[model samples]
Target: MTKYYFLLFLFLLAGESFAQNNLDSLVQIRGFAIAAPRPDGLPDFIKFVNEELAPRKVNTLILRVDYNYRFESHPELRDSVTLSKKDVRKLVDACKKQGIAIIPQINLLGHQSWAEKTENLLKVYPDFDETPWVKMPAKGEYKWPNPDGLYCKSYCPLHPGVHKVVFELVDEIMEAFEAKAFHAGMDEVFYLGEDKCPRCAGRDKAVLFANEVQKIRDHLAMKNQELWIWGDRLIDGRTTGIGLWAASYNHTYPAIDLIPRDVIICDWQYTRDNQTAVYFAMKGLRVVTCSWNRPEIALQQVDSHVRSRDLSNKELKGRFYGLAHTVWSGPTPFLKGYYANTQDPKDGDKTPWNTFKVMFEKIGKLETGH
Candidate 1:
């Protein structure tokens, strides 16, 4: 009888493992991407997570924390309006109660500045700037195709002291959110391997980008955590004709093969149905299809995600992990618009709030078979 019971236990454990694997084959991450709320707006954001996100089954919440948190390790990098540890705990508790995984983001290699204003990292340590010669516009907004060819600034990946400061911020933010994954916003990196920079000059752009990704991934691996990044910089812009914004033009696309496969890529395309998720998946990386402000395209992305998972081989199906709706604005304005049903005549159906609703409603129906 004791031997019979032992055999039965083994049989049940095998069944459970198979069931879990079957479930994992489907869309595993129903995500919502938004900026971290200010300290004052924390309550409302928490309420939204409880009321809106929970009901729709948003399992993954990627909050763009950037420099918006009060860091004990580097208090100098804190933004003027930031979330305190107390504030972070409230948000974390709300998410934990709802079974939502929180992934905190800090823009690492790129997006260091917007228009004329420099971001906190470069402002604090100016020596890290990859293109120190490319100055921001003094008066009006920075224009594209400018003399400096600037879109957003990037820090030199080879800078000796850069990772120490950034990794400190990463560790602190991950600890505060109790996150299993860290989203390093390494997207739209236009300024890399510049000729003028001492360390990175004449070096291979793809290697520089890949090395940085590996470094971040290795750091997270120490704690058995994962690294997530935007997929734009990994596409061959010139060959694919996906253009510079959505893909890479600076020859960094080849880095796709060099980086660790465990890194999750958030492949975003707003205007049209760009089926680049397949590219990432085929390349042995798990990818989430990200959409912004286009409900039609967002719905298509949802269908694509489901279809890819359903049709692909077992090896590739799980790599097409899920879909995420990205909100480019802050939580306060977005939540206000979402609740009020606010729509501009000019935008029509092209709004992130509208896409958020449509995307999740479709996800809810798909998951339930309704």
Candidate 2:
């Protein structure tokens, strides 16, 4: 009887140790929520914080606020319906109390388009267009998945005066949110080295690409902030199916090798095994997997992040961080309880990020006991 009791104690200790190891592996579970600064949107966005985001053990929010911020530096760049600096401060204080990091996303290197539906950057400065003569399409002129849609304009990275305006805009957004890191939206930059642009023409595409990323990284470094960008642009499209999505247009690989080692890569893969996350991890850059609006995909991404950590390779160890699931489509649902997404295909119409949020919460609670 004494021997039996001794063996049981050993078994219980081993089990607890295993649980700790599993929990320690994941650093954070984040939501990529975009905040619309309108009056109607602010209430829901705040509710998303107090109700959904706080309870779930979701410690980070990579908010893509866009031009919704009221900018003192660039008044023309802000939308007519924008969040006042005070409004953002309230959310920041609220989020701080809940122990969540509010990282603001600003469109930096690419994403300048305005036909019918408008984006503010290039809508205000047309000469900033990378391909000014590509014949900008009227809003809704191109159907979804149209490669012509790939022609969405980008500002010339080589333009002499572009970064002056870009830096001021970034400074305003970062200061307003009191952000620790900045997400420079440098994905799907399709128009590099175009003949229509005088500055970018005949430039080596790879040098041009790495230079743009380094410029942003260096700018953020001055203020002692970290730089983050989507991993799609760094992925090798020919090998990875990620090429099929927004684009593999420039196919910038080996280029990831050129940027600062401290820069975080937000590797978003909606479908496929997200081998890109592993590849980035292997390269010694800190990486996190991002999921789009699907439950099964989010589960697989979390699993992939875990399985990647389980590998024996020393270079692949430790630098791989956490997972962030995106909530792009809206009205953003304000959920009551924190629950992880399951394998059921017909699960009620929650966005992929919501499902992923619950999934992370479930895993995170086991570790932090939150």
Candidate 3:
């Protein structure tokens, strides 16, 4: 009888695992990220969760483990100031207790800078430097404000040694957090064929994108894990000259069919209500509608995402997934103050994070028109 009970226990555990996987089946999962640093130099993400998420039923969080600054994992010297292991563990534990899926983001190819004065990555990989279309002759440099004392010049994708270093970054995060899915950022692939780099000079942009994506996919596959990437360049077909450098601003990509359809595409529009969400759905890809965090920028993004979802239902027989809002740069003082003041609002633009929770719940209501 004891042996029979042990067999039953194993069977029950397997069923439980299966059921948990099914929980993500119907689509439309909500998520947030600690991308922007708050005024106190610490992201108030945990506070946001305690004060906002628990009440609203948000269950997924994406923490960007690597931002403008370099972590210890960098092959070159490490940044002394980095988030501690203890804090990361605390974050994971807190989210787990709330039943949230934590997906940490590590930029693989671009957005490497944290500060202009310091050399976090650009100094290490000088060959990857891009000649900006709008050059500053006086400064003899063309880089954006890397407010956090980090570097920005992206590592050259064609550089053989860079892969090993990037892989180390990804490995460190996966090992530390034990997250199931890794977000390998392949966004904003500018500097593709800067005159200085011979390896990329004449290569077709689409092929270049596919090549980099495949490298990431292969690396993740070896680790028995899956990868998610932003989906703009791929949508711009090869014929359209829609590489990351310019495609994003125009919201034009070739076609989705040519790229690996299995990958989840985050179709985002921040300025206006759009049908791109519906277009992505019709392409048979998993779509997550993204809204921006800027109070001025977020409402239109939120309305766009919500409207897109509704349109998808009517236009294509596509599966509706969920909502996500991206907060770019360190938490701007204006936005941060707005959120702090309005977090417990009786009215006004609830922070984009707040908007996401509300929009996500509305996805369920859409079916019944509640």
Candidate 4:
């Protein structure tokens, strides 16, 4: 009996080791990101998920669900056209059947306003605006490099009432999607720690940024969900020469060291292969290279990500998570362009639909070991 038990133990140990090795060999994540479909468009979106995404082995879908859902917790914040619980369930069911992880995103802190219009949160609660002094321009009067230096508006991180409302929405949305991860869109945060704000006037921008990131991360951690954010705010624009849009010109880059290591960074670059993924990995954070509207650059990003994993040691290789193709347009328009196989005359080959097809095809080939 003793001899038989010893043999069984050895067999189990060998089986466990083999399973671990197999998992480690496979790509960690194959992801696609886009805006969530409107309620009327859910059927087509689900069909795309079942037919296109599943065949290509996309295991992760990040839907930008910012203010697009019917919120019970905060009814005032709901968009005119929104996803009901039933609509969210359809998406959830589709992704679950395909073995894809669905992560819902809300643009937090920054992206409170666009060109000349304010988004829901700040519109409903005017006191949350980080730069309330700089008024938004009229509909057609908005331009870059204006005297106000306005790009997108950010909510004051130090506002006491901010998180109370934000957290409620976060919880409601996460529950609706049944998501295990939440993407807080914290990219291109230009206004932080501005001198005019009553509460946040002279605070360190890096500390403020890190504090907000850590707060969100900690809140999610309680439920054991992960927090993902864009990597641009954590990168130094001046030193890297990647400039303000792709990286950060504000002093918040130091937040890279201050923020928790577990936060996943979506490092995005459009026109060129920035190689900033390596920097993130070196900083002891897992990073996914994100691309938009540039097929060539997207392809290069895939090659670079694969190579990074192949060449690095075990300690560093895992930090090079994978690549995510980002679509900036609405789901309906993107689907129309994708099915029609048409490119924007103005954008030509520099369209997100083109990049999406090319990048994912490469990813599919890689997954098959072809």
Candidate 5:
């Protein structure tokens, strides 16, 4: 009877081990770090990675190399600007040392402007400007605001030549950094089937995205690489309301199965109640929860969101990959200003420097039930 009991216990342990490994393989820890800050008082991106990010078992760093503020229209602007190759190298080296892979994120489809300060890429490739929202008035200036409040000039996804340009840019970035995964910025793609574009007028919105995703996926696959995309646009109508959320929202568009399953879905919600991660995972897609640097309220939200997602999803419990905290330098543009905002004592005294610290402490409590 003791032998029988021992044999049953061994089988149960093996089953648990298999389940744990399966979940761990799917859960990727996504993070956004200041990889290429301007020259003035650049924080050692490497030091931060080594000291902060690595210990958290963060497997992926979504390095923000955005062009809207850093460089516009001319990719060549990267040459004149502040972030250097050496800075990138240091970060990449640190990432390698820490066993974390870098997936460099360049804003490709939209979020293409910091303001009118930089010349628009759409201006150079007018054929590629896919936004039906923006009517090019007779005077040639883009129709301001475009009915929607968000300021975005979308590149036409239908244009074959546009893919060529995008591929070229992707190729350049891939060659420069040698990262295995590339984050194809497909967030908030409002202009799915543009009204004026004859090429896009009659196509299904879901099909349009699927085709586009396939195009990038095929390109990356050829180069022996993979792609990661935002999960907002892929929520299926059957499981959830299709138009339940505003079009601007991450979960606003179609079904998860619309895109290829291989593509990583960055399930993101900056709100305190981060229920989106659970929904995404339930749909049989991999998920990564994302948060941003906000006020003290934001950290409270993150804590709540993390706990909700982690505890609520039992089948996907260990499958709940990890969390991503973004340090956005938008309103707070300067480094000191950003540091102050994230470091504000009210922020649970938890800045980016201390996020991992808090995370582990919470994790320890979760593990210990203390």
Candidate 6:
């Protein structure tokens, strides 16, 4: 009788293990990183989320506000058409109901301006510029991403005034949105530790990179928030193809081993670089795959992400946090083109934009399937 009871107990234990091995054990993060809505377009943007994104299970948003908030610390940084506190509050409330997490992003390191003559933070606070004396390219000569253009101005991370205001800006945004995670726009930092700056001259580029990441992470830790950053600059260009938008700062990836593992890396790959996710995950950092412009490629990459996590390996399991569809060009044009256009004229299939939108909608339906 004892032997029989032992055999039955083993059978029940095996059944329990089998049940745990199913798909539900896998984790998925469905997120969207979008541009901050203009004040006039706020209502339409909110309505679109209620009507579309919520139904589609887009549970997270990485909003690129880029000094678009009326800051209490420094009003000078606020753009002419910044989002009011009420607007941010309203967005937070709306996201809460949809089970979505909103992480507001401020361009911390790169993207001082989109174009050569564009004006922004670095242009306003000249002292913060890492290579302030570096002349702007002469009339479209050696434009951005050329490695010599030095298009995007990086603030001297060592400057005292830099963090004083940036931290205040971060504090205000996190408080406004009640965010648990904050995305620091730290990609494409080309002008780091330049010889021009008295403060940062001759400093190790990797140390500068790692120090800045830790500084941001420490600030977030004070509020019990997690730090999220673009994984492009962290990638080694030798093994991976660093694109135009994501420029490597002279191979500063050695900083990866220096920073904390809890920092969530949003590993965005528009091409076959989806394999890069494993590099981050293997290093013990949480990761999310990001895509934009190419829906088929996005879908394929995301599929690969899920499949990688579903494997039996201990390191691979539960590392891929989720998939994020980053619509860098705001939803207005995307929606307009999606509504007016069908598949590509040449290919006779839906445009990449439409294909991506449809995928989100399908996921929403699947989430609430009857």
Question: Per-residue CA lDDT of candidate 3, range 121-219, in tens?
Answer: 555666454432222223435345433222344566787677787788787777767777788766665445445565666665566666677778778
Q: Residues 1-370, candidate 5, lDDT per residue (tens digit)?
A: 9999999999989886765454344334645534445554345445556765676556677765554223323465353454555656665777788878888776666655433422245655676767544544433454545554435556767777877666776776666566998888677665557666778777777777777888888899998898888766765433544342312333335645576666776765543444666666666655666655433434453455456555655666544556665555522253334345455556555454344345444433432245
Q: Judged by lDDT against the true structure, how good is candidate 4? A: 0.91
Tens digit of per-residue lDDT, candidate 1, span 259-368: 99999999998888889999999999999999889899999998898888888998998899888999999998899889988886898867889999998888766744
Backbone collisions counted per model: 0, 4, 15, 0, 7, 3
Task: Spell out the clash pairs found in candidate 2.
Answer: 116-139, 339-358, 340-358, 340-359
TM-score of each: 0.93, 0.84, 0.71, 0.93, 0.72, 0.85
lDDT of each: 0.92, 0.72, 0.57, 0.91, 0.59, 0.76
Which scores greater on lDDT, model 1 or model 5? 1
What RMSD value applies to candidate 1?
4.8
Which parts of model 2 are misplaced by more than 4 Å?
1-25, 114-118, 144-151, 312-315, 330-350, 365-370
* Poorly placed runs, candidate 3 (over 4 Å): 1-27, 36-44, 67-72, 75-77, 113-119, 130-152, 235-258, 293-319, 331-335, 342-369
Name model 1 segments beyond 4 Å from true. 1-25
Worst ten in a row by lDDT for model 6:
361-370
Candidate 4 similarity to native, TM-score: 0.93
- After TM-score superposition, the amount by which residue 8's alpha carbon in candidate 2 deviates from its true location, in angstroms, is 20
Pairs clashing in candidate 5?
130-156, 232-250, 234-255, 234-256, 235-254, 235-255, 236-255
- Per-residue lDDT of 154-244 in model 6, one digit per residue for the tens? 8889998889888888888898889899999788787788887899888888889999999999989987999999988787775556654
Q: After superposition, how far is residue 61 of candidate 2 from its true place, in Å?
A: 0.8
